[model samples]
Target: LSEIYPRNLMRKTAKMGGLPSPSEFVKLVNSSASQGDIQIDHVEVIAPIYEKWPPDSHTRIFLDSSNKTDEPVYAREVLSNFLSRAWRHHATDAEIDQKLALFAKIRPKCDDFQEAMVEVLATVLSSPKFLYLVPPGRAKRSGKSGDGNRLAAWELATRLSVFLWCSTPDDELLELSARGRLNDRDVLVSQVKRMLADPRSRRFSRHFVRQWLGMQLLDFLQVDRKAFRQFNPSLKEAMQEEPIAFFDEVLKHNHSVLDFIHADYTMTNERLARHYGLKDVYGNDFRRVELDSTHRRGGLLTQAGLLAMNSDGK
Candidate 1:
């Protein structure tokens, strides 16, 4: 009866209470269950079962498990769905038919319908029509005749959102463009403010700071061991994170940009804190610490990262 105790009961107990010794707990539970004082209706099994299939066999068994046969019309529907999602617009009847014809040509060579669909998806993803941002209809001049073409409202909105927010246009921006109101100053400004307020705007600050400080190459930069024996891989990683974390706090909390030049508070982890001669710091996590003028660590130039990078080889 002790051997009959369900494995899942032991697992659940361990998960909920935190297992210190799993084997001992399991043995104890099994012994108690086998004493016949407690009734055991069922034993829970937790181990996963493995199945072996042929190397060439399609793992997606559901693809042809249905008695329903593949229809040409269904292929067209699949193509339409792909185009709609890829282009973010409704597909024309001619476009759908053309894709269906391509699918029909490729379907016979593939053993399964899913394999045929994969081929179509690959083609669609690779096509210039899906990859490039193209304006609908013919190119027309804006104000100058030689300028070629002006960006459509949707294109302009998408470009602006990607530039400022580093993401796709949100529903509000998309709707404004769809309604031909995206270019309106008040509407555009409102959308801009909303976008900037979103969490995605942190990407802009991260990108800007990384590029401005040349910290983007920190990963590839080689550290001199003779000059700074303390600068190991972990120390280098902490150094990279310290500046970014400090900048993020300043931007998120609306601190002045000048604070970066001479902020009283800066980020430091245990390794970095010790490296810079900071006291009362422990653990691997980084935290902002206020520095007094007497400490003489007022700016980023005084930080260990910059000092290590600029030091002469010993």
Candidate 2:
């Protein structure tokens, strides 16, 4: 029964138009898992499981019941680090002391130091300082002059990272903000190029294209099997990814945005190529493919996914 599972899975996948046949799926899996194709370029451990913290570390000071003298220092260090990383800027002494007071109040009721600290950190995470992109020196809204006119270095870094990567700024970005170099136009352009080259920028492309083209329509799309026996779930999935990949390609090559309306090429995986009646392309990976007159396909206007999704499920 276990041996039949892989074959059965492949049959279902093939029927959904993911694979040409069960044999092809097996071949693709075998090729991928083959030892000859495997390579280990490098390995770097970012964090290691530690039974104990090193000397003078905040965790060590906090955990040692005998080190009551250093407990305030430990709290300050921990809270300050949390503020920098989570709130994306330095915390004032008052802010750190407030969190420390919370930790002290909760300490007696909690089972352990870790549990007390967890509650303190939860408040930090919940604070608007961490949750929202409120520019520095602009925390309070004011009708008076010069209150929220400009962004601080840290605020700009957070905005740039969130806009381009859909994530918080990395150490490099934060370091630049610390040194006050990120605001320089040349430095900013270089950082933008570096970020776009990084794979994280794919999130930007996917998110922007989805919102711009209203791709949410595809998510609720329901097709009638009897009306279009040739249409399969795999094809629909490929259709959804096509626009995102196409947008990424144009951004990658610095192509004019006009190409989206009428280009001689489109992005496709094997499933989508077959749906469009294009020949010879294979594999589940999408790539740029040149389209000809016979293909009668070009841009977002003629893409089957967009057409089917907007239909009445006929």
Candidate 3:
């Protein structure tokens, strides 16, 4: 039953009631359900399962299943793999050993192996190498000759991922980077197209539009409730999303840039459609809809959010 518990509800409970131990949390849930507080008809409670104990098949071969004899070997492998992803490059033997030493020092104080490993992993994540887009002195200090003048393949991949996905490079991008092919003209263009086709590229649209159009103002801008009784949070959220969705629509279709100034169609969802007094728009998801002159709306200039956020709420 605990496995089936919604993650968000657990987070909410933690926030409101304070964090509880696993047993205490299950007890709280059971007590709530039994008292008709949770409103559940059925619950089959089961003991907690430790999914990480056996380790998955990809990782299993690195560990000695019978005992802790191969723990150091396993730890080094884990750190190396983690560094490759987090640092966006291969970890040197020295780097791997440094983390392994940290794990060894922390293991004696922690209750279990997993806890100490988690601390080591956290240290890796918090590293300057992991935090910065391209860590200072890396290009100039790298072992590769002539690297000081230009970005490394791995650094280029990281920048491209940050530009398109707003996240770390996936396996494919990392592999291309590792092979030093990410900078090739044809390969770079192909990867760009591939990245744009990915769902993660939506982050590019959302973030680029927000920054370029100064939509961050809308985030903290307070709409006066008394002055605009019909302006609710849902409508405000729809307004905030409109321009990004509108930009994405034009970009995906390769429409003319002029559409931004005066498009015959606009992206909208139910809440925003209602605000614009349009009919037949359903659901929260934004989609392109043909516009008519009766709506008296078109382009980024006509977005409700841009107008409202720019106002003093009078």
Whose lDDT is greatest here?
3
lDDT of 3 by residue, 82-117 (tens): 787887776778889999999999888776666678
- How close is every model to the real structure, measured as TM-score? 0.57, 0.70, 0.78
Predicted candidate 1 versus true structure: per-residue lDDT over 1-314, tens digit per residue: 34432233444332123444443334423222112366767646453323554222333322332433656755666666567545544456877787778778877877666567766777777877666766645433345642322236666676766667776566677677777787788988888777767878768766876787777566666767887676666677777777766776786677887877787877887777777788887767778888877675555666665555454433
Give the per-residue lDDT of model 2 (tens digit) for 159-195: 8999999887888998898878888999999999999
lDDT of 3: 0.76
Note each model's CA RMSD in angstroms.
14.2, 11.5, 7.1
| Shift in Å, residue 244, candidate 1 | 3.1
Worst 10 residues of 1 by lDDT: 27-36
Q: Per-residue error at 107 for model 2, in Å?
A: 3.6
Q: Report lDDT (Cα) of residue 314, candidate 2.
A: 78
The top-ranked prediction according to TM-score is: 3
- Which segments of model 1 are wrong by more than 4 Å? 1-101, 111-114, 127-151, 170-172, 197-199, 268-271, 277-288, 295-300, 306-314
Model 2 scores a TM of 0.70
Candidate 3 residues lying further than 4 Å off, grouped into runs, are 1-69, 135-137, 140-151
What's model 3's lDDT at 166? 87
Could you arrange the candidates by lDDT from highest to lowest?
A: 3, 2, 1
TM-score, predicted candidate 1 vs. hidden true structure: 0.57
